[model samples]
Target chain A: MTMPSVSDSGLATDAAEGSVVLERVTRAFQGRRVLNEISLHIAAGEFVALLGMSGSGKSTLLRALAGLDEEVEGEGLIRVPTARSVLFQDSRLLPWESVLDNITLGLDGPDPAQAGRQALASVGLAGRESAWPGQLSGGEQQRVALARSLVRRPQLLLADEPFGALDALTRLKMHALLRALVGRLRPTVILVTHDVDEALALASRVLVLGNGRIADDFRLDLDHPRHSDDPRLVGYRQRLLITLGVTESA
Target chain B: MSAEGSTLGGRITSSTPRTAQASSRPGGTRLVPRRLTPLGRLLGPLVLLALWELAAQTGLLSPKLLAAPSTALITGYDMLANGTLLPHWLASAWRAWWGLGIGVAAAVLLALASGLTRIGEASIDSLVQIKRAIPTLALIPLAILWLGIGETMKIALIAGSVFVPVYINTHAAIKGIDIRHVELARTLGLGKAVFIRRIVLPGALPGFFTGLRLSVTSCWASLVVLEQINTTQGIGYLMNRARDYGQTEIIVVGLVIYMVLGLASDAAVRAIERSTLRYRKVIGS
Candidate 1:
């Protein structure tokens, strides 16, 4: 089935850049199909959250979009901007490099150091430029990872459970930080997560992946700074949880 | 009734205090200090030396077999004053430095080749493993046949022994680098040179230093064995000559020199390792 075009979706204007389109993307491992004939489209400046159970292929779809699935057997067309960055669950910072260096790593053009400093400042890590990755706490490391991702001014930002390893309080703080950053950067973001509350908290559109296909796709029309206890969010959360085959106890 | 109540209250309060003190004392004692001051570190060695001196003075220890610490020290000083120690020490140091340098260079090149490429691993790794199984001393016979008993053979033996630890550790470290970082590099569009410079080299450093410590010790060890092979001007040669004259003090001096050299080189490597790997969060900072 064909998906709606960006114009009809009314999510973004610059459909030419920072947009992702996939058609009949099929990924398999050991004769088992993880993603089968899955088609998806994301517009520029859209915050899309992909939710799935274990082995539901949410990460696979994200990897394919990021062009990191070359070693995996897949047959499909994936169109993504060349200027894209991926944030994994772990910070993935080079431990030997300082925070500023990690941010500016592979950055081009004149005075990349200034840009790196600004990026660090933006993530509330202004004076931590010389700090090693091992010296920073987990939450701090994730913030540095966020800065590194946004430093390049990537057109598409693909995150695979970036805050999964953080504590609950840290996760809440990161959720807010990510929201503010994504708001300002306006990059098309695809956040693959298992937490329904996180998806509802950050994403404008949420998609549930199950049985190697998109099982549910819907939009949350809530305003910014969404509360988990909001009745509308509660309704969406319950439906999403049920779609994920998880029943909430009364 | 008032006396009975007062005695009961005093007994209860006394038991509570004792229990609190017991609990607090264990907590205080549980925190054993792990760090030692420099003087504290020297205490054991100093005590051992004192005991050795006492044994020698009491005549319980034979000077014929092992000279007293004082005698060894005087002998060492005499050798230093008469200029007999400098040339021999220099010769051994020179041999060790050349051998270590060559071995480290070769190990780095070989590790990069084997660790970075499939074909290099297929061709080089197995050969290194095979060489590792055969001790470098075992090849001294063959080396003597090939290069003859000279500086060349001595250095060759040292280099051959030093190469194994460095190559094995470096190659393993390169292979053990987090694959996620490699993926990050690709996503960041890093070229081959940049990836090697930023990721591969730094990632391999800790392992390389570990191997280097082993290599340094091996350099001294093989030198001792190599110097005995018809050498005229190394510590080993001096010790061999002393063996003929039965001058045990000079032999003790030779042993002391080797011990100091080995310790100093290892300490040097450790300093460099600490500076380079300061990023790591290890015990005792």
Candidate 2:
């Protein structure tokens, strides 16, 4: 693939545009193609949820969009905002550093401590500047991780099954926190998950990957504070579960 | 209300602030009182001393073989009053200080060299392994032949004793950091210098302290051996002199000093570990 636009610094040329465009992107490992000629465009401030089965290349596609995987042997033009951040399934916090330092790490600014404090406060972690990551609960650690990502004020946030490891209750709390933060920050977010209800509840647009390509794309016009039993979402959930090959009875 | 919506608001309002605030407020209250441990540590030594005094007074144990606690104490006090113990103690302390300092510096340098790069590991690791296989005491003959029974030989011996544990532990610590953190550093665009300073150095610290505790004990042991080599000063020299004069009381004093030094250094390292590793006080830890 010719990456004429992706610079050596990996900063997006059209960063202010805050868009992601992938054209005919394909990736293979040992002659087995994992991603096959996938093309998609995400506009600024759009919440996009990617859904697929375990090996359906959902994560591979998300990694590509995040500029973390670049060894694909296919013709494509992948463009993402230079100001971008990724939140993985694990909260990947530095165990030794305090929560505030972890958020402000490698930060370039006039007053990073102040910014870190503000970010922590936004995540409801105020007065936890001196607390270590290990001291916090799993949900709290993920909140600090969220604060770390949001401290950069990225235009694009790519989250890969961030709440997959969390318990059901913690996942609900995280979903609410994520929704509130995304509403406030309005970054173009692409969340990768297999949870059909999560995608239906959180995303404005949900894309389903099947056989290494985009098989279904749905636009949901549901209002904020969405309910799991909204009755309107049952069809989308059933269709997504069917797309994921999960039979209702089996 | 659905199960999800009912729990969502209740969970958010009830769980978020209470636990976060509760966990953050335990720093002062959680520290066990410092006064408790001194009494605990003293109990063993005090009971032993009492047993020794009773045995000496009752004549159950011969004083020739083992000096009484009172005799050892009087001899120690007389040596202190006559100004004999101070010079010997100073000389031994100076040698230990120089030897341990040099050894730690060299070990840290070697560890960084070997731990950071494949080339460094290839060059230094095999030679260090060979050195580690041989005991430091086995090198005493060669050490004397090379540098004679001088301060240089003694100091070098102590340095050699301290080198292995510090280097091995520090290197392992550097290599043992989780790769996920390295990815985090790269994703954050941390520069090479910053990565070494922030991640590599702090990550290696716990192991470094472990190695330091080991090396401190070994450093004292090496001194005990090296100071017996035609030494006119030091605690080892004092003990050697006392052995000839059949001054078992003085010999016991020397032994007590060594014990004190070892205990003190270990306690110092433990204090540092406690303060630095306070982050490890997670639930059930």
Chain A only: TM-score per candidate:
0.93, 0.93
lDDT of 2 by residue, B7-102 (tens): 898878886775655555566455665555657978988999999999988999787778898999999999999999999999999888888999
Q: B1-285, model 1: which lDDT tens digit per residue?
A: 999999999998888866545444465454676788879999999999999999998999898877899999999999999998999999999999899999999999999999999999999999999999998999988999999988898888888889999999999999998889999998899999999999999999999998999999778777667888887889888888888888888999998998898899899999999999988878863
**Which 10-residue span in candidate 2 chain B carries the lowest summed lDDT?**
B21-30
DockQ per candidate:
0.70, 0.36
- Candidate 1's interface RMSD, please? 0.7
Measured with DockQ on alpha carbons, how good is candidate 1? 0.70
Model 2 / residue A41 / CA error / Å: 3.0
- Among the numbered candidates, top DockQ falls to 1
Q: Candidate 1 - CAPRI tier? A: medium
lDDT of 2 by residue, A42-134 (tens): 889999999998899988888777666645444466788878888989999988899999999899999999999999999998999999999
Ten contiguous residues with the weakest lDDT in model 2 chain A: A2-11
